[model samples]
Target: MTIKNIIISGASRGIGFELAKQLCAENHQVIALSRNITPLQALALPNLHPICFDLQDQDAYKGLVAYLTEKQLSVDVLINNAGKIINKPFEDLGLQDWQEVYATNVFGVAELTKSVLPFMNKEGHVVTVSSMGGVQGSMKFPGLAAYSSSKGAVITLTELLAEEYKETGPAFNVLALGAVQTEMLNEAFPGYKAPVSAAEMASYIKHFAMTGQQFYNGKLLQVANTTP
Candidate 1:
């Protein structure tokens, strides 16, 4: 198999961490980005490169581009898996709360994708991770007004990007995930048991991120067995 240079965000734990570990085990060069990369560094895998990255930081994007340029790495897959959520009732949600969520979920995804496009291989894939709550008429909860709406925005963004870049080469797709037993899930829904584990979901995402572009572009696949 041809080794691919893959970039994944939110790699400190959960699905992102599993993706980094699994991809490196397969001999792929993995660039794992997260605010706290200590967990990733502990793995000490030669093929795994952990970088301290904050999705909300503008300076971090520049640093990432510089690092990629310095390493002369051409990205084959870019996974926008980093997300932020504030679980507050709509009436209690302040402007800052909404901004914080969108900064990471929507704006960060857009900025990071744009920053990495020049380094992407013509046949590369960009996968943005969304939530089932974002899909219109799926299932609405009380405390996800900001989080869910931001996710919906990215779905449209991905479609627009795929259309614009269709003639260029690289492809864009978004995945609306179902409930997974992740730290984020535990935080959002305390004491709730999810049918899927983080590693299990990560495995599916790993396979999809590497090969899904061959058959899908500008498509939103709802990877959920249960609703939130």
Candidate 2:
């Protein structure tokens, strides 16, 4: 496979870190973005460029767009993996909690995507990481109403974007991922053991990230063997 220029959000750790490692191993140029890029810098891959920025910061997202534009770089794949979770029951959750979750999961993804659209290759692929909880009829957990709702919003946003960009622009899709072993998961559910590992999820994400534009668009992929 020809090397592709890929941009991955939340690349400091977890699934994002693995995605950067595996994609760089495949000789792809990876632009890794995260609030803390120190971990990414430690990777020391020649093809990996680490950008430190909070996805919730609109100015930072715009700065990234400026950098890409100045370099005349077009991305083959864009992975929206940065997300925030507020694990509080529906009754206990406040407006701030909801805003915090949506800020990172939905608003950030949308703003960055809008800025990056011009830098996407004609056949570029856009993959947004969502949660299985966001998928209707899937398993629901207590204290995840805010998190689930944010992810669900992104899923809808992604599909709408896919339709808007269907004939021209890039292809867009959503991965309503199942329980994956990651820091976020542990934070959301203490002592919970997930069937899928972060590395495994990253591998699957790479597969779809690389092939989504070529095969499917506007589809919500359920990346779980069984409902959690």
Local distance difference test, each candidate = 0.93, 0.90
- On a 0 to 100 scale, what is the lDDT of residue 96 in model 1? 95
Per-residue CA lDDT of model 1 for 5-53, tens digit only, reads 9999999988999999999999999999999999999999999999999
Report the lDDT tens digits of candidate 2 across residue range 145-226. 9999889999999989999988886999999998899998899889999999999999999998998777888889898989
**Candidate 2 colliding pairs, count:** 0
Span of 10 residues, lowest total lDDT, candidate 2: 53-62
> Which residue pairs does candidate 2 place in steric collision?
none
Candidate with maximal TM-score: 1
